[model samples]
Target: MRKWLTGAVLGYFLYGLFVYWYIYMGGPDSIPEQFKGTSADPGTFMNSRELLLSGEYSRLRNFMYFITVPYEWFILLNVLLTGLSRKMEQWSDSIAKPDFLKTSIYLFWLSLIVTVCVLPVEWINYRISLSYQITTQSTTGWMKDQVIDFWVNFLLMALLVSVLFWLIRKYQKRWWLIAWTLSIPFSLFLMFIQPVVIDPLYNDFYPLENKELEEKILALADKADIPAEHVYEVNMSEKTNALNAYVTGIGSNSRIVLWDTTLNRLKEDEILFIMAHEMGHYVMKHIYVGIAGYLLLTLAGLYAIDKLSSAVIRNWGSILKIDSKKQIAALPLILILIGALTFASDPLTNTVSRYQEKSADMYAIQLTNNKEAAVSSFQELSKAGLSQVHPPFLIKLFRYSHPTILERILYLEEYHAEEQLKESQD
Candidate 1:
C-alpha cells in the first residue's frame, strides 16, 4: 500500500513536469516575418513590435490558462474527487437502498460536489474573460447557463451510468466490449443531434440574415460539393466577443454555423474566407475521420478503465467500501483513471486536429484564391480571440487544437500566391 501510494505521488509529479515542459519549454520566438502582423498585401510582413501583444495583455491571459487550468484539472480536482468518492461510498452503504438507486444517488451527490468545488475556478476563468471583454454574459446569465449545463450533464450521466452498470452486472466479464460497442452509436447519435437539439438549449440560432454573404457562402459550399442548405448564425454576442464559424452535424443536420460576432465584426471577404475554411472541413471529410478516431480512442480507453478499475477496486474495496463496478460509488475511481488517461492522450488528439485544421486552411485559400483575405482574417481572429502568436512548443503540442494563428499566417504566406496564380491560369 505504501509503495502504491508512493508510485501514485511520483506519477502525478512526473505528469506535472511533463505538462510544465509542454507549456513552458522549447519553442520558436515569434511568427516568421512575412506573416508577423497585419499587411496590406499577401506577402508583406508587419514590424515585430506590431505583431506581438503588449506584455500586460499577453502574460496575464497566458498565466490564467497555463497555470489555472492545469492546477484545477490535475491537482485540485484529482485530490478532491478521490476523497469525495470514498465518503460517497460510505454514505451509500449507510443509506440502505436498492443497488442501482443507491448508485444513482451517490452519482447525483458526487456531481453536485464536483460542480461546487470547480465553481470558483470557473468563476475566475469567466472573470478573466470578462476583463478582456471576451465574455459579455452577466453573472445572472452565466449562472443560468451553469444550471442548464449541470442538469443536462447530470441527466445524461445518470442514463449512461445506469445503462453501463446494467451491462456490467449482466455480462460480468465482457461488459467493457459491450459498452464500447454501444458507445459508437451513442456518440454518432449525439453528433447528429448536437447542432439542432443540444446547442439551441444555450443560445438562440437563426438562419443567417445577410443575404449577399449567405449566397457567397453557399456558393463556396457548392464549390466544395457540400449541401449547405442554409447558413445558420448563432447569437454568440450575447455571451462572447470571440469570432468563430464551423461546419457541424452529419447528413441532413449538417450545415455551416457562424457566430453572430463573426458576422458582425468581419468583412465580407473575410467572412467568405472563413466560410470556405469550414466548407473545406466538410469536403475533406474531417468530421467522419474525427469520429472514427474518437471511436478507437473510446474503445481503448474503456478497455484500460475496465482492466485498471477492476484491479483497483479489488485492492481497495474493503477500505473504500466499493463492492463492485456496478456500484455508483465506484464511479469516482473510474473517472479519475479516465481523466488521467485522457490527459495523457491529449497530444495525440491535438496533433490530429491541428493537421485537419491546417488542411482546412489550405483548402480555404485554394477555394477563395484570396491570400490577403485569409491572412487578414487570421489577424482579426488573433486580436479578437486573444490567441498567442507563437505559443511554446509544449503548449502547441498538448493544448492547441489548431495551428497557432501566427503559424497559420506564415504558412498561408508561403503558398497562397502560387495557388492563386495557378487557379488564374487554369
Candidate 2:
C-alpha cells in the first residue's frame, strides 16, 4: 500500500513539474504580435499590460487544470488503500439501524472526507481568483458557498449511492445496466430542477431590469420562433467579474440567463449577440443532446466500473479490505475508477463541446448579422475573464469547451468579409 501511494505521489509530482514547465517555460514568449493590440489599438485586441496579466493568469489556471485530476485520484486511492474507507463503513454500520440509513451515513462520510482532503486545492484556486480580481466574494461568503455545495453534493450522492448499492446487491453483474437505466430520468430531473430550484440557492435571479433591453431580447427570441417570454438576469457581479450568459433547464422550466456582469460590461448590441449565442443552444437542442451524451457515457462508464471493480477485488481485495462490489467500502474504488475514466475521456468530451459552441457561434452571427458586436463581445469576454486567447495544445484539448476568443473573432471577420465580397459580385 505504501509503495502504491508513494508511486502515485511521485507520478503526480512529475506530471505537475511537466505542466509547470509547459506553462511558464516552454510556451510562446508572448501573445502573437497579431493579437497584442488589435481591438482598441490599430492592430491588436489587448494592450501590453493586459497581455502580461492574461498570460500570467492563463499559466496558473492551466497549471491547476493539469494537477486537479491527479490530485483527486490520489486522494481517492489513499482512502481506499489506507483502510480508511473500510473504517468509515464500519462506523456507519455501528451508528445506523436501517440499511438505507447506513448507506447514507457512509456516503456522507465519504463525501466529507474527500471534500476535506481537497479543500486546500480549492482554497488555492479561490485565492488565485481573488488575487486576479476575478472574484470579489469574501472568504466567509466563499466558505458559506462551500458548505452549501458540500451538503448539496452529499444529498445527491447519498441518494445515488443508496440506489446503486441496492441495485448491486439485487442484480450483481447486471447492476450496472439497471443503474444506468435509472440514471436517465434521474439526470433529466436534475436538469429540470436546476434553473428553478438549484440556481436560486446561489444567487438572486429576477427578470432583466432593463425593460427596453428585455423587450429587444424577447423580440429576438420571437423572431427565432422561440417561446421565451422573459429574459432573466442573475446577481453575479457580487461574486465574479467574468461575463457570461447561458441557457438552462428544459420545457416550461427552460430559460436564458444573463450575468449582471455581462449586462454591465457589454453594450446593448454585444449583449444581444451573447443572448443570440445562448438562444442558438436552445434552438439547436444542445441541452437534449448533452443529456443523451451524458446518459450514454454513464452507461459505458458504469459497465467498465462493474468489470474493473470485480477484477480489483479479485486481485487486491485482501490488501484493500474490500471484499466485494456490494460492500459500501468499495465506494472509494468506484469513485477512483470514475475519476480516472472521466479524465481519460476529457479530450473527446471537450472536442464535442467545442464543436457545439462553434456551431452556436455561427448561428449567433447569422441570426444577428452583427459581426462587429460579435467580435468585440468575444474580446470583452477574454479581457474580463483574462482568458488565454491561444492556450497550449494540451490545455485546449483537455480544458477548452468553447473556441478561443481569437478563433471566434477571426471566424466572424472572415465570414463577414466573404458575405461582403459576394454582395459586391451580385
Candidate 3:
C-alpha cells in the first residue's frame, strides 16, 4: 500500500515537473523589473503558443482578444486543466473504494455529462477568470496551470478519499451520517488553518519591509476610518509569477498580504488602490459574511443528512449507533453531507463572491479619492497579467467573482469622467 502510494505520488510529481519546465523554458524574457513602476510598455498580447514569451502589450491584446472570442481564449486552457486535475483527484478516490468499478463508472459518466453540458458552462466560468484586470497566463502557461492544478488537487483528493473511505468501513450502516458530522469540524479547521497551513506549500510568504511605507499605509488606514498598524507581503512570484493581494483573518491574525509581483510591479498610487480595495472587503466585513454563510450552510446540510440517511439507519442502524439525538460513528454521514454541500454551493458561493468583489472595487475607487487612479491601477494589473478583456455572461453568472476586465474598465472610465465633471463644476 505504501509503495503504491509513493509511486502514485511520484507519478504526479514527475508530470508536474515536466509540464512546469516545458513552459518555463519556453517563457518570455523574465518580467523585466516588476514593481519599480508601471511598464514602459502598453497594450495586449496574442494568446497563440508562439507569442507566449514576447511580453508586448499588443501581443497581449491580441491574446486577450482571441480569448474573448468564442467566449475567450482562457476557457479552453482553464477548462482542460480543471478537468485533467479533477480526474487526477478522483483517481485516488477510485483506488480507495472497495468497488473500484462503481467509483470509476460514476466518475467517468459524470465527466462525460460534464463534457457535454458542463463543459460549456465550465468553459464560461474559466473564461471569466481570465476576464480580469491583471494576469500573465500565456496559452502555454495557462495550459501548464491546468496540469499543475490537477497535481495539487490530486494530493488533497487522495487524502480525503482515503480518510473518508476508512471511516465509512468502520461505521457501516449509518456511515454517511458519521462522515458528514466529522466533516463539519474538519472543514472548520481548514477555514482557519488554510491561510497558514496549506497555502505555504505552493508559495513562500513573509513579513513586509520598509517601515516608512508600512507607517504611511497605516496612516492611510486612519484616513479611511479604519485602524491598521501593520501589513505583510508574501513572495508569490516564486510559485507561478502571479500577482495578487488580499487581507486574511480577523483581529490579531488579520493581516494584509501583498504578492511580491504586485508589490514589485505597482506604483505608489496603484499599491494604494489595491490596498484600498482589500480594505473595502475588511470594512464591509465580507469575511464575517463568508464564515456565517458557511456555518449556516453546514447546519442545513447536516439536517439534510439526518433526513436522507434515515433509510441507511433503518437498514444498518444498529452498527451505525445513531439515534434521535446522539451519534457515535457519525464520520461517514458527515463526509457525505459535506461533500454534497460542497458541490451544491458552487453556484451560490460564486454569486456571493461576485457581490463581494464588486463592492471591493467600488470601495477602492471611492477610498482612493480618485476614480481615474483606480482605472489606471486596474489597467496596469490587466496589462501585466495579460488578462482577457471580456467574458461571456454565462460564465460570469456561474463562476466569476469580480466584474469582467472590460466591464471594470468601462465602469472606471465612466466613473472617472463623472468625478472629473463634478470637480469641474465645484
Clashes of each: 1, 6, 48
TM-score top scorer: 2
Off by over 4 Å in 2: 29-43
- TM-score order of candidates, top first: 2, 1, 3
Q: For every model shown, what is its TM-score relative to the native structure? A: 0.86, 0.96, 0.55
Best by lDDT: 2
Per-residue lDDT tens digits of candidate 2, residues 1-426? Answer: 878878888998898888899888876634467655554331266777887788888888788868887888788888888999999999999998888999998888778788998899999999999999998899998998999899888888888888999999999979999999889888889999999899888899999999999999999998888998989999999899999999999889998999999999999999999999999998899999998888889999999999999999999898788999899999888988998899888888988988899989999999999998998898889889988887777778888889877677777878888999999999
lDDT of each: 0.77, 0.88, 0.57
**Candidate 1 vs 2: which has more TM-score:** 2
lDDT preference between candidates 1 and 2, better one: 2
Candidate 3: regions farther than 4 A off: 1-189, 302-344, 421-426
Candidate 3 residue lDDT tens string, 53-112: 333332334333323332322222232223432344356355654543433343344334
Over 250-338, each residue of candidate 1 has an lDDT whose tens digit, in order, gives 87888789999998899999999999999888889999999999999988998899999889778766654566887666676677777
Sorted by lDDT (best first), the order is 2, 1, 3
Model 3 gets an lDDT of 0.57
Consecutive 10-residue window with the lowest summed lDDT within model 3: 72-81
